[model samples]
Target: MPELPEVETVRKGLEQLVLNKKIKEVLVAWDRIIERPNIEDFTNQLIGEKIDSVSRRGKYLIFHLTHYDMISHLRMEGKFDYVQPDTSVTKHTHVRFIFTDHTELRYLDVRKFGRLTLLPKNTAMDYKGIKKLGPEPTPEEFLLESFNQQLKKHHKAIKPLLLDQTLITGLGNIYVDEALFKAKIHPEQTANTLTFDEVTRLHVAIINVLAQAVEAGGTTIRSYKNALGEAGTFQVNLMVYGKTGEPCPNCGTEITKIKVAQRGTHFCSLCQRIHL
Candidate 1:
């Protein structure tokens, strides 16, 4: 799944390639991908609207159109490709937007788990998906005090707490493991058990990890790609996420993998000790 950085990369790509391009037509090759409104209504609503801008919230892509905001979630293997009209559509191409410039924006999803929904232009920010999300980890609103307060309210393991979208909107398994390792906090450590210093360290680590990931265009673990079909390079800088039995970067101890909250978690046992 594409997390914040990957989604942000796609948003930047769409902004450059599709912005101000009027939609000549919309073809929903897979109706299940449209989560809101009937497929016919969705196609009708976006036909003549222009893509004003593209933005991201958490893992969702927000396409600002003339009269509506199109929310897209690339759940697993979804990707957008910008190409000419003559470009060949692949078997996985489920949605295609024909632009007035004779270009095409295609959505390809091998897993078919991606989703799209349309909301009124002004009410998009208040939509259910965007409204309930917590503070973005990279923003100033995710202050140390605010983070500390949110941590105290959750009694779950630190890893799962960090993954909670209602608490910190953008973190996923990859970044959470990296952030916890950077802060030297074990994934299984209870959230409320974190000391003030630990909380401070974690706060800094989350911001730094996410900012760096966004800078690197996000990690490409599998089939994730940006809107321009470029793979991210952050996977090269990863320390412990997928390095099972590998030497730890900080302590030379072998990194270990465990299942935390049902997600594969990696850590250096010597560097990140559980606080039980």
Candidate 2:
């Protein structure tokens, strides 16, 4: 799944590639990928619409068109490519937005899990998944005080609590492990038990780690690529997410992997000691 940073990268790429391109035609090879307005309505309504801009919230992409907002979620295996009209269509290609300029923006998903929904103008933010998201993991939005308050109310394991997207948005398994390791907090630590100092460290770590990941264009784990079809470079900067049995960067302790809430978790046991 493309996490926040990966989605953000895609938004930037789309902004560069597809902005202001009037849709001359929309082809849907797979009907189920359109989640709103019925296939016929969706295809008809977007006929003359121009892509004004592209924005993002959490892992969702918002394509601001001339008359409506198209909400896109690139669930696992979903990707977009801008190409010529004569480009060969692959078996996984699902949606195509051919522009008046003769260029084409195609969406392909091997797993067919991605979704595209069309809604009224300026109403994309009200969508249920986006409306309920926690603030973007930035210093300005994810404040320390609110995060501290939220942490005190959760008794679940810290890793799962963070992954819930209620405490903070944009953190998937990869960034969570990296942030916890950077904060020196164990994955299994109870949320409410974190001391004030620990919480402060975690707050800074989350913001910094995510910022770095975004700067690096997100981690390219598996087959993730931005709309430009470029793989991310942050995977090489990863400290603990997939460094199992490797020596910790700070201390020489070997990293360990465990299952928390059925998700694979990685951390350095000596670096991230459990509070209990």
Candidate 3:
């Protein structure tokens, strides 16, 4: 799944490439990708809608059109490619948005798990998935006091609680592991057991880790790439997400991998200790 940073990267790329380009036509090779309205209605309604801007909430991308807000979720292997009209449409290409300028924004998903929903203009935030999001992982929106209070209400293991997107949105398995590692909190630690000092460290860690990842264009894991067809560079700076046996950067201890809430989790045993 493309988390906030990856989704934000795609939003920025789309803003530059597709803004103000009126929709000449929309082609859907896979009908299941359109989640809202009938396929015929979706393709027909977008015929003259111009791409005004692109925004992101959590892992969802919102394309602000002239008459509607198109919410897209790139579930697993979904991605968009901006190309010319003559560009070859691959077997994986499921949705194609042909612009009046002759350029194309093609959505390709190997797993076919992506979805698109068109709602009234300015109503994208009220969508169920986006409505429940905690907040963007930033200092301005994600405050320490509120986070501490939320932690006190959850006895769930910290990792899964964070992954739930109700505590702090935008943290997937990768960034969650990294943030916990930076805070020196074990993934299995109960959320309510955390000390205020610990929570403070975690609060800062989440914001910093996500900000840095966004700056680096998000971590390129597996098939993830921005709309510009560029892979992210943050994977190179990762400490322990995929490093099972590597030396821990801070303590020289070998990193460990374990399953928490059925998600693969990585942390340094010496650095991150369980509080349970």
Candidate 4:
């Protein structure tokens, strides 16, 4: 699934490619991807609206139009591509945004887990999914005390707590484990038991790791790609994620994998000391 960095990359790409383009029509090859007031209503609302700008809130791609906001989530395999008027649509191509300029914005998803929501432009914050997200994980919002407060309220394993989109948005399995490993904190550690220093480290790690991932365009773990159909370059700079049984960067001990919150977690046993 595409996480924060991946979604943000797509948002930026879309902003550049589609802004100022008016939607000539919307064709929904998969109606189930439309999670709003129904495909017909959504299509009618967005038909002639101009795409003003594109941004991201949590993991959803926010496309601000002249009259409404079209938010789309690339749940798993969903991707957007800009194709010429003569380009042929492929098998998994589910949604197409035909532009007045003779170009088309195609949405392709092999897993069919994507979602699209259309809401009023001025009321975008009132949208249910966007309304529930926590603060963005930028430098200004990652205070140590605030992070500690949220963690102390959770008795669940740290990894699972971090994966909760309600607690702090834009984190999924990949980045949670990566952030934990970078902080030298074990994935299975109880959230409530984190020491003050551990909390501080974690707060910093989340911001640093995510920022770095965005810079690299996001981890090209599998199917994730930018609007240009290019793979992200962050996978090469990873420390421990998907590197099970490999030597740890900080210590010579091999990294291990275990199930935390039913998600495969990677950590360096020697470096991420338990009960520290």
Off by over 4 Å in 4: none
| lDDT computed for candidate 3 | 0.93
Residue pair clashes in candidate 2 = none
lDDT of 3 by residue, 125-222 (tens): 89999999998888899999999999999878999999999878999999999999999999999999999999999999999999999999999998
Ranking by lDDT: 3, 2, 1, 4
Error of 1 at 112 (Å): 1.1
Ranking of all candidate structures by their TM-score, best first = 3, 2, 1, 4
lDDT of 4 by residue, 1-276 (tens): 899998888888887788899999999999999998798898888888998899888998888899898888888889999999989989999999999988999989998999888988867778888898877888786567777888888877888888878767888888988888888898888989999888888888888888998998988986788997778898998898899999998887999998887888889998887773
Q: What is the C-alpha RMSD of each candidate to the true structure, in Å?
A: 1.0, 0.9, 0.8, 1.2
* Candidate 2 weakest ten by summed lDDT: 76-85
lDDT per prediction?
Answer: 0.90, 0.93, 0.93, 0.86
Alpha-carbon shift of residue 35 in model 1 (angstroms)? 0.5
Q: What is the TM-score of each candidate against the true structure?
A: 0.98, 0.98, 0.98, 0.97
